[model samples]
Target: MTHLPLAGRRVIELGTMVAAPFATHILSQLGAEVIKVEPPTGDTTRALVRGGPSGTFIAYNHGKKSLSIALDTPEGRDVFRRLVASADIVIHNLSPSATRKLQITADDLAAVNPRLIYCHIRGYAAGPQHDDLATNPVAEASTGVMDDHRIDGRPSRLGPSYHDQFAGAYGVIRILATLLQPAPTAEERRIEIGLYETGLHVAARDLAGVQLKMQLLGRPEKEGGGEFSMPGYGAYQVNDGRWLYLLVLTDAHWQKLATALGMPEADDPALAKLRERKKQRERVEAAVRAAVGKLGFDEAAERLRAAGVGFSEVLPLERVLAAPQARQPGKLRDLDYRGLHFEAPEFPGQAECSPGLPPPELGEHTVELLRGLGFDERACAALVEQRAVAVAREGDFAWAPVRPEASGKA
Candidate 1:
C-alpha cells in the first residue's frame, strides 16, 4: 500500500460537536494520527442519542484516538502540554473564555512547542462579535444564508450544518497549506477559522449579485434571494409521488427535455433562446408539470436518461443510504461500535482505501497514550484517581444496534 500523505503527522484535536472534530477527521483520513482531547465526560454529541453513538458523533469523529482529560486540573494541563510538545498540529473549537480559562490557546501551547500549527475555529473573526456565541444556524442567519433559503417569507435553516462543514473544510485547507511552508514561524503557524465567515463565503454568490445589481443597475435586491428564476430548473412531483429536480441550463438541454417529454411547443423558434424561455417561464413550467404529472417516476427517469437530460430523484434522508449511488462499491466504510455495526460514507477521495481505526470510545486510549507520554504506571493511576483523566470502562459502553435491520449483512 502507498503511504498516505500525512502519515507521520500528529494532530491533537480539542473539538466538540462538529467543526473542529470534522477538520481533524479529514486529517485522520489523510493519514495523520489525530488525538481527540475531550473532557472526562466525552464530546457532547456522544450522548445525543439514547443508545449507542449519535450519528453526528459517528459521522465526524471516526479514525481518531480519544483522550479524556479535565483541563481544569493541573495534572490534565501537564498531560496536554506533553502531548503538544510532540504534536504537529493542535485544533479546537472551544470558546475564547474557555480556552483562556483552560490555558490551551495557541499562545499558551506555542510556548510549549513553537513548531505546533495551532488552529482555532470560532464563531466570528476578530471584531465586535468575536466573543459572541454562535452555532450553525446562528452563523447562517447572521451571514444571510438563512435569508437566502427562507421559506414562506421566514428565514429557514438549511437541513444540514453546511457552515460548520465548510469551516471544517477550510480549516483543512489552511492546515495543509501551512504544512507546505518550510519552517514557518510561530506567528505564521497560528490559524483561525470563523463559522460566520464561512457562512458568508457560502452565500457570496447571492450577496455579490445583490450588490452588483444595486451598484451597476440601480436596482433593489430581489425579495427572495437564491431562488432560481429560470423555468424547468425546479422540483416537480410525478404520478408516482417522487420528486425529480430538472435543470434546463442551456438551450440544448431545453430542446432535449422538450423532445423527451413530447412537448408540442418545442417547434417554437422563439423558445430556442434562454432569455425567451425565461420570459415565458410560466408556460414552459406548466408544460413540464403537465407532462411530468402524467408519467410515473420510473418512466420519467428512463425517458430523461434516454434523452440525456439532467435530472435526479430527490431522495429523502431515510432513503439516501439505500440509494443506488450510495450502495456502490467503495462509497461507504463499515464500522462497528460496541458490536453495533453500521456504515458511513467514505471521505472524499478516500474511496476504496483504508479508513484507519474506528472512533475511540471515550478515553479509550487514555492509559496507552499516557504510557507513551512517559508516565509510569503509578503516575497514570494517580492522574485517574484525581479525576484529571478518565479511562474507558466496560460499563461505560452499551451494545444497542443503531440499525439492526442492516446488521450482519454486507
Candidate 2:
C-alpha cells in the first residue's frame, strides 16, 4: 500500500443527505480529513435506524467528524467562518436562499481564505429558475432522464440516487481541478454543479445514440436495437432462474457465440451481415434466448467463458458482498466501528496503516474542534450554554427541536 493522494487536505462539508457527504466520503477514502457540520438534531439520516445508522448515512458519512452548531446564532456563524478560514475546500448543497441567509457564499469564504476552493452542489444550475427547491427525484425528472428511460410507457427512476451521486462526483472533479492550479497566492475559485446537469452528462452516450438515429432515419428509435441488433447483448434467464447479461457486439464474438450454442443456422446467408441480422432480430433473440435458457447457471457460465463471451450474473446485494472477488486482497476489510461490523472497501493504493473511524454522534466534536480554533475551555462551555453550539457527552443527548428562525435569520 502507498500513501493516499489527499493525505494533508482538509474539507468542511456543510450539507446533509447524499451528494455532499458522498463527495466527502471519496475524499476521506483518499486520506483527506473531512469534518461534517450538522445542526443539533444531527443529519436526518441519523434517526433512520435500520440496525444502526441508516445504510445511506453510514455509506457516506463514515470517517468524518461531526460538529453540531446553530448557524442562526451569531456565535455559530463566527465559528463556521473560522473553520472556512483554515480550510482547503468547503462544500455545501444548501439552497441558494439558505446560503445567503447563512452568509456561507463563495465571496464570504474567499474573504476568509483566498486560496480556498468553494464548491456548491445544487439541484439545478443558475438561471431564472435557479431558486426552485429541488431534490434527487425532481432533478432526474426535470432533466428528461426519467422520461428517456421509460419502461412500458411509465417513467422509471434509477434505483439509487443517481443524479445526486453523479453531482457529487462532478463536485470532486471540480475541486480537484481547482487544486491543480499553481499557488503562492491566488484568488479563491468557485464552482457550482447541478444534479440536473449531471444527469444529462451521465446519459451522454444514450443522448448521442438518439441524435444519430434521428439524423440517419429521420426519427429517433428505442435503444438496444439500431442499425444492428446483436441479440447477444441483453439479459437472459437461465434454467435455474438466474439472470445473466451477455455481450457479443462484434462479428467475431457472434461467431464464437454461434459455435458455443451449436446454432449453425446463425451463419445462414440471410443473417451473414450485421444489417441482415438486424432484419432477423426476433429470430436471433429467440434462438439465443432458447439456447441460454436451456442451460443451468454453471453450464451457461462455463460455456460463456469458453466462448469468450462477456457476461455477468445478476446478484442481489448480499450475494454481491459475499462474492469471491470481494474477499480478495486489497478489495475489502472487515471493520468494526460503533458496535457494528461491516465490510469496508479498501481504496486502491491506500496506506496499510490507515485506520477507519466511526460515524460521529451529534455534536461529538464541537468542543474539540472549536478548541483547535483557539477557543479556551471557558469559551467553549459558554457557547454551549448560550445555545449557539452543542457537545455530546456520555449519558447525554443533544437532540433538540429546530427552532423557527427569526424574521431576518435562516
Q: Please give each candidate's TM-score.
A: 0.94, 0.89
Off by over 4 Å in 1: 223-227, 397-410
**Which residue segments of model 2 deviate by more than 4 Å?**
50-52, 184-188, 224-229, 348-353, 393-410
Query: Tens-digit lDDT track for model 2 on 94-133?
Result: 9889999988888888889888888899877877767777
Positional deviation of residue 147's Cα in model 1 after best superposition, in angstroms: 1.2
lDDT of 2: 0.79
lDDT of 2 at 376: 99
RMSD of each: 3.2, 6.5
Error of 2 at 292 (Å): 1.1
Write down the TM-score for model 2.
0.89
What lDDT does candidate 1 reach at residue 333? 84
